[model samples]
Target: MTRMPFKKLALSTAAAGMIFGAALPASAAGYTDVPKESSHHDNIVRANELGIMTGYGDGTFKPNGQLSRGNVVKALGKYVVKHSGLTPEEYVKTYGTASVPNFSDVPNSWADQELVMYSKIVKDMGIFKGSNNRLMAGNLITRDQMAEVLARTFAFRDLPGAPEISDIGGSAYAKSIEILFENGISVANPYHPRATTSRAQLATFLVRSYDKVSKEESVMPASFYSELRKGKVSDAIVQIGSTLTELKKKAGDPEAEYDFEGGIRHVYGKYEYGVPHPVLEEGDPVTTVTYYFDEEPSLEEVMRHMGPVEQTEEEEDPMEYDYLWYHKGDFEVFFEYEWGGDTIDNVTVKSNR
Candidate 1:
């Protein structure tokens, strides 16, 4: 049968949960090139785990490599398939073997016919408006184009106080970049709107977008399974006293990490784990566990979960926020309230000794 010509390519963030929800057996960053110091370390590693972004056969993740239209569609397709609540077997049965719409440039002999099929879904979704029967799959995607794609995918809402980025003056995608800025997503330091987006930047964009996208999807998309991705003290992967080694072994590489106080701090979305001072190099017995929420939990809710507050202390930066402390045997838990607020925005577990 003769295949019909296709029109476009694009994907939705709603499909990311399925891609990253499964259990990972080992470290997310097995790449030889990206170290903890690399700016792209966190995002690249996390993206790797999600299968939304990946490296070549070589043991290197070309963080600085430029992305092509073909690769972008493929990655987005993986995200959607994972989050669509269907297993690989189901996807293969439904999409892989099903009628795949063909792009003019993406030939029948393409190495991965699966990717060709994914582009079909993306085009069907209207992200890829392949002009003149051509889906320049080998062409690069500019930073501006990426912004437009993400804005449409995540349905970025207009927020106040958006930053003005450079190089998009009269560009058609200026509005898209504005939406990203308003939504608190930065593209790159230079904001090179016309430049091709790098692998590192793309990974960072996807990882950073998880929260924003989840919040926008009111029905509560199954981005990850509750059993697979744990949070909160009751279901947290790591505890107040967990060793750094244990944290890494269980949680994989953090999306962001840094040296804080004496030990190290790792950031996984809104969750932060820290181990400070003495035995810092050995990386054991975590010193703190902190989690932030988009909305502050009420005092009553805090008490309901953690019992009565034992003490309250005004922050040294008194205008910044206040802390409500509750003792848990040798451990201490604190509810942090932003100044002039009625509820708590963050909760932390730490050593009382």
Candidate 2:
């Protein structure tokens, strides 16, 4: 349990959740040095233990790989099943057929079941459309596309109260963005709507949602739960009040794109937990020497093993994962980890997606 040379600050700040990639356990940072024979040898091993995501082919978890739209969709689907549990049939019945157009890329036989399932959800939510009414299943998905899909899937219909002057404008996604804002689903840049999203950002958003939807007894920290049981309103509020406040501010924006009749809808997704490291900035010591541990450490006692911590600068410009550490300059480091047969690693360099 090595402590950093820097001051030991209690992680009680309102923005701590944002820094940690949405309440991720400290073990997600993985040790800077790993043993070759360790059971959790690859990156994302800790994330896998937390049941957030999985890895890919070749027995390696490409944690730092760029997250594609398909990957994002699949991950979202996994979360839905874990948290919301919408069966394929149920998903299709609720939001598919009508919204998804027939496409040559996605034939009835190819990914037929998955296509129907996702299309129904996207369609019913009115967040996604086929490229020319065709589901481009084979194409790599982008960050912007996922943002819209996530916004719609979350059921953010309109901004809260009256739309501010700035909130009222933007492309078709403006309204949806507003709704996302109001619901704490996203906090968009005041200046742009087409800004890119990052894997870390997505992770944080999903984690928050997990907290919102999970049973209070399930996700709430035991200490906090004890307080709540004793009706310690102040203590319980302290644990989550700031997060709730941030979400409240986000609600200011309205969902202008599609106006669903009944508020926002809740979709299923998994909660990925891991410590996020910032990408280094230009002129910073190239050998500052941080570690990315890829092992399944005991979450209860892992924070002590992070070694003497030396926090870096706040990202000048927010990327998708700005809430975590920002990738400075162009070069980024993505420590790979394998989890659930998928890769989940934080990128420290330029945007991977």
Candidate 3:
């Protein structure tokens, strides 16, 4: 847990892809201490604009100042509200009125009320923890601790393919740190997870985390669909949203066909090098792409590529799950997950017609 020297880190690929609309605009003279040439200037400005972090009344942002745990919780509470779509009033109503204390150190005093509430909320969500009934609110938070907070806040564990961190494999925050790296939030090679984070560093991390979540909730751009409509199909399209007509055009003809109730089922091998290999037997090691013109593609496929459904209907039947819907730009996609099965039986994507 030795601290590594701070160096200029590059903006992550995910951070670069973020729509500026997701973050507030930066002011030219946001903070006196943060020079325009500072590595963390953009993030600090963005955080200030978003009201996630701020400076002193004298217009100086102590960029290199150590961030306290209480302050971190306060900032993260605002972020959680934004990321989870909770109104500020709703958040206050939910956590503000609770009289029960989760930590012995967090007294019922008015001075500590806000921090205590936020601490309880984050703790309930498994983001923050206390040892020996004390939250250590005054202590400066470490980089690894920050990782755990972000990871739990955004539920980053569900994201696929977490990368390995050479130095922090054995730490308690290892998995969370890996998620941070995998999502392009932390680009530091020797991540220095145990080092105390500065206000500037924390601001950068929070803004990047927000960007990552925004990207996850986003769908493929309209330009992508325009390419798909023109029969320009690629591996990227398969991983996201695409029409059966487009998939057929990309994969060519199907090897086998079967009659279903409403439409014909066309089955194609997972094509590689312009060749479609056949499935010899049940459970064979082969790539299968099934397209039912009357029905949509698999639910798993849609969710896998398009992220989670934004809305879902409540189920009337106790045994059944609700139908899910996603609206991405001009596209509307629907999915129905079958009972006792991972595959989504029905999917339909419609454009503004």
Q: What are the models' TM-scores?
A: 0.51, 0.38, 0.53
Model 3 accuracy (lDDT, Cα) = 0.55
RMSD of each: 19.9, 23.8, 14.7
Report clashes for each candidate as comma-separated counts. 11, 50, 0
User: Residues 1-353, candidate 2, lDDT per residue (tens digit)?
Assistant: 11111111112122122211222333443433334454334323433344554333334443334554545555554443323233555544532344445444555566456545554444332344566766665565544465456554443224336434263364655554555556565554562545445444455455444333332222223332122212222221122112222322434322221212221211111111111133122212222111222432221111111111123333443442211222222322222223211122321222222
Superposed model 3: Cα runs more than 4 Å off: 1-26, 82-100, 157-164, 218-353
Assess candidate 2 and give its lDDT: 0.35
**Winning model by lDDT:** 1
**Winner of 2 and 3 under TM-score:** 3
Comparing candidate 1 with candidate 2, which one achieves the higher lDDT?
Answer: 1
Q: How many backbone overlaps does candidate 2 show?
A: 50
Q: Sort by TM-score, best first: what order?
A: 3, 1, 2
User: Pairing residues by index, what is the TM-score of model 3?
Assistant: 0.53
Q: Candidate 1: list runs displaced more than 4 Å.
A: 1-30, 49-51, 56-58, 87-101, 107-111, 160-162, 187-190, 215-217, 220-353
lDDT-based ranking, best first? 1, 3, 2
Best by TM-score: 3
RMSD in Å for model 3: 14.7
